[model samples]
Target: MTLFFLPIPVNSPLPDLTLADILERTIELSQTAAVILKSYYRGSPAQLEVIDKAEGPVTVADKAVDRHLLDGIQAMCGDSCGYLTEETYQAGDFQLPQDWVWIIDPLDGTRDFIDKTGEYAIHIALTYQHRPVLAVVAIPESDRLYAAIAGGGTWNITADGVRTPIRVTGGKELTKLVVVASRNHRSEGLVKLLAQLPCQQQLKIGSIGCKIAAILEDRADLYVSLSGTSAPKDWDLAAPELMLIEAGGKFTRQDGSLLKYNQGDVNQWGCLIASSGEWHQQILDACLD
Candidate 1:
């Protein structure tokens, strides 16, 4: 692993690297983490050992990749920023975060990975003052990576290192909308909400990163989550949100409230709506009213 993420002095300001420099290095770092996953991922579901957690079934790959990312970043940028990762944040005390935060979900779709569904993804976001400025979502199975930096737009990075800028399919007719949703976490309450959408189709995809990538790449038009008896944390939303937004999309509560990261509470509960930008209000009005 090249560890291109951060090789700078400690206590620095979010690395003096330009956004382009940071974005490229983060893309490289994502593939390194993906290698950790690929090494342990056998074709069979029972290949890796897993332990049940209050959150979900966490596999050894999750911890290994988390350690890889954490150790790599901390070794390079000690005290430069605070971290709020899925596997580690809940184990410790949660407090107000620093001005700079790296929100990570090492393995976002663990169930999909275990099932060999190939819909899982890795999310890494760098936030400043509680807003994401750079984001990357790497889907190793599909060989597709989505990335964005504030004011710089989003790109689809292929396995062979090709980069193509991407954006959302801005607003469509209600009946023509394609919904990108969960494959595993589908709940009855969520089903009811989906039934009301009048969308052209509902595609079951795993991981918020994947769902948002679908929107950013124009594979789908919208994704809405009602918490479904459980809510996604900051790690789940931050990166994908920035990716979609830079791609000319919007992500927020159904009531139109924007999400803030690194807050005291980790959970981002309630109706989280993500859509191609222009028609997002239609989703809110259609569902909430």
Candidate 2:
């Protein structure tokens, strides 16, 4: 087996590492997470040990992967950097020192994982100055990894380590657009909005990462989330948001505001849209009451 490791900048602090360096390290970390997730997933069903949380169901695999990612990030970046993750994050966790913060979802689609669907993923993103600067999304089931840096473009990496550049399809007519939505958390508001869209096709998928992957791979043109009382948290959006933007697509609130990270409130309390930059404005207009 080839052992993958992140090379810490010699005699330099984490803050000194360039965005490219951070992107490289994050990819390595995500690959490690892929191994952990695949191991748990291939085990007997009994090993899942599902537990209910106020937000939803969590499994032993979720917590274990969360701890591993948190510890590994802290070890590499130092404890001074802020950390926010789906498994262990608290409401106020984002208030910590934030020169740099890691926003992560150890297992992005726990529901899908528990249901034996292979659409779940691991997300890790580095946010600086309230914006994601680097990100990695690992879909272990497909043995594929997606990564991006703020201005460096996006790429897909296969299990064999081959990298291919990826981009969103250029603007298509609304009637020809293909939309994807969350499989497990569909909302009535989203359904109503989708009805208004001129999209010709729709798909329901399990993970935020997978839905975003569809857009990146040109399999889908847009992903929409219409939130109600509870909304997606920082961990859910950070990594995928960066990847979409880097792939020449756009992700934003329904009102067209950019997502800001490391805020005390982790809940993204509003409708969100991801689209190939071409139809973003039109989609937002269609959603208007």
Candidate 3:
């Protein structure tokens, strides 16, 4: 029943908040999510577990960190905007405010987290008027984070705190492409689709945002998802969508349609592809065939 947003300021001078500031703060929140997740990981195994209404396992780390990130954003951005999150927002009860909104997934790869595979990540994306303008994807176990500020470009922070710019590699052929697919969400349709391709390699990773991060780093060439009746949530791809586009990559639905956010339905069903821009459409067509 609680609506989320930044409070409208009447008298106080507006802070000179920029996309960079938002990105920096989002990274900080991601680190916070990391700490929370790590705490659960190191705690008594029996105590850090949970079960959601959908019968999905919701570990202590997941809910705790989800609250932490949501609270963190609320504290920073206040009541002027709205919030949409994987763990908190109910589709029927909430509608996005007209101003800025946040789309978040506190623990994206929950299954991987439960298994302690270190492939999970926390996703934080900022949307203005329903389109992502700033985003952050943090992989705590690996000590890596990827961020983008609308036009600010994509950046990577190494485990040691070193920062580097990231971009998709240009002009790679389909035969030599290295695709990164979802570790747990892969569909039989996608497997059959890829089987027809002459791709050189594929890496199955957890989290859509995390997979996009791989593409941003050029570690893997592409990230593809074949959706079923249930589409991906807005929180699921909002950040990755902008981050990948700003990183000079292509992100679109399986049929090559552009993605739009704040559609009420969070799930993004259908074929989805993220590539370094050069061969994005080629991969889409191949998958469709």
Candidate 1 C-alpha lDDT tens digits along 1-289: 2212323222324457565666677787898998888877753556567888777889989998889888876655579778889988765336645777888899999988887888889999988888888888998887888888777778887888777778667546778888998888878988889888867498889888889878876788899988855788899899999898888889989889889988777878788899887778888988875
* Span of ten consecutive residues with least summed lDDT in model 2: 1-10
lDDT per residue, candidate 3, 1-289, as tens digits?
1111223222211176645655677788888788788878767878765675452467778778888998888887887667888888765734575557888988887888877778888888888766787788888887888877666677777766677777778777679889887777656777887787668498888777778878887778887777664556787788888888877888988777788777666667677788889987777778767
- Top candidate on lDDT is 2
How well is each residue in 1-289 modelled by candidate 2, as lDDT tens digits?
A: 1122334222222667655666677788888888988888999888999998778899999988899888877877886578888877754644656667888999999999988889999999888767887789999999989987766678899988888878888867788998987788877877888888877598888999999998888888888888886888889999999999988999999889999987788888888999988989988988785
RMSD to the hidden true structure, all candidates: 4.0, 3.9, 5.6
Q: Could you estimate the TM-score for every candidate? A: 0.90, 0.92, 0.88
Candidate 1: RMSD to truth: 4.0
Residue range with the least summed lDDT across 10 consecutive positions in model 3: 1-10
Which has the greatest TM-score? 2
Better of 1 and 2 by TM-score: 2
